[model samples]
Target: MHVVMTSAGIGRIEDGAVAVLDAPYPDPNTVIETTGSLDALGGAKVVRRIPLDGDELDLRAPLGRPRALWGVGLNYHSKAERTGRPAPDEPVLYLAGSSSVSAPGAAVRLPAEETVQMDYEAEIAVVIGRTLDRAAESEAWSAVAAITAANDMTARDVMKRTGTPALAKSFPGFTPLGASLLARDAIADPDAIGVRSWVGDERRQDSSSADMIFAIPELLARISRYAALRPGDVVLTGTPAGTGQDRDDFLRPGDTVRIEVDGVLPLTTHVRA
Candidate 1:
């Protein structure tokens, strides 16, 4: 089942029909309150049923504001090769502010600086379901609630100058999360999924979660050792090779970045440079 956040409430879409769940805003609360528990996401209380075929619904970000937005860098060998950086033994984690998230369709508004060299990083974002602290790799997967597509938009100039990832990528609307979230139960295999992206017609990234240097289970377990992960906390799996930086082809006005996680809706972000 797909979980969507609309102005009305949380929407559960399945089998061509949508059941509007009677819940509150921000997925962290909605998942637990209406369902009484995050683990049983399917048990949410439905307020109304609407056929998705001809319905027009105003959707919002599945996670209104993630409590913690953790990003992994150089997790893919291809990305490491492209950047001429060695793949790290452990997941390279950086924290971006929760306010960076925007609706899937929202435009990436660029800063007015003339040196702006905006780039796109397509990532498979994992949203934690239950709280996990010092969890083991074997049990880390169980704490996952859902998966979503994300564009980890970055300002290359800022990163190149200050060498601080959080500052470069934490701009408002930099993180375009999702149009819909795919529950973990709906995926046949959470560990293996296709992740790709495009800059208008040019396909830039083509990779799989299976190609990650540090897989999901290890990433979660590794992160939990230092900090606790709660519901709605997001982990941005590293983007693959073929970013604009590889060719010095930064984003400009009218450029659209489209990213996809196999099975979920494609995330599109227009550029306003």
Candidate 2:
């Protein structure tokens, strides 16, 4: 199922129509009402409907406000290599504030005098559907509800000054989320999802989850061992090699960054100062 947040409500892009869900947008009840089972959305009544391609709608972040956004660092071999560092022995994790979440078509306003070296990381984000505490690899997938694309935008200046991934990446509108979300079951191969990113007219990253050193199952299982993963929580599975930091390039006003994750929605963000 392809889920989207429309002005009317949470809706599904299926059955040749954009069927508005009876569940309200930003309400966790839709999933929570069913014990965090995203499959329960299949049973949600359609309050109303619109043409799938109609212009009478506006798209918002599919999840509205996720409970948390867990960012995984150096999870991709190519990404680590880009920094001339060896792949880490463990998942480098950071807890980004959910306040940074932005709608798919939103604009990213660069912080004034805080940082100008903005960068983008194209990543595939996993949306949790259940409460998982110390889950095993075999149990991780079952805890997942959907997959979405994320532009893990970073303010490199802040990171360099603070040396904290979470703080550096949690600026408002820093985490560009989605225009659509794909139900987990719709994906045949989670491990091989293709990920790509573009900075303005230039293509910056071109890699897939296949290049990730620690896959989703392992990442989720490992994280669950320490922190409880709950419904509406999202895990950003690091980006590919090519980034502005590696190329000595950074985002500037008027630049547009686009990220696409195969099997889910793609996102585009316009940069502003």
User: Root-mean-square deviation of each candidate, in angstroms?
Assistant: 2.3, 1.9
- Candidate 1, residue 203: the lDDT equals 94
Per-model CA lDDT versus the true structure? 0.82, 0.84
lDDT for model 1, please: 0.82
Could you give candidate 1's per-residue lDDT for residues 15-54 as a string of tens digits? 7766787654456336642342344546768888777655
How well is each residue in 60-97 modelled by candidate 2, as lDDT tens digits? 77766677789988888887877889898889999998
**Weakest 10 consecutive residues, lDDT, candidate 2?**
24-33
Clashing pairs in 2: none
TM-score of each: 0.91, 0.93
Q: Indicate the residue-level lDDT of 134 in model 2.
A: 88
Clashing pairs in 1: none
RMSD of candidate 1 to the truth, in angstroms, is: 2.3
lDDT of 1 at 79: 85
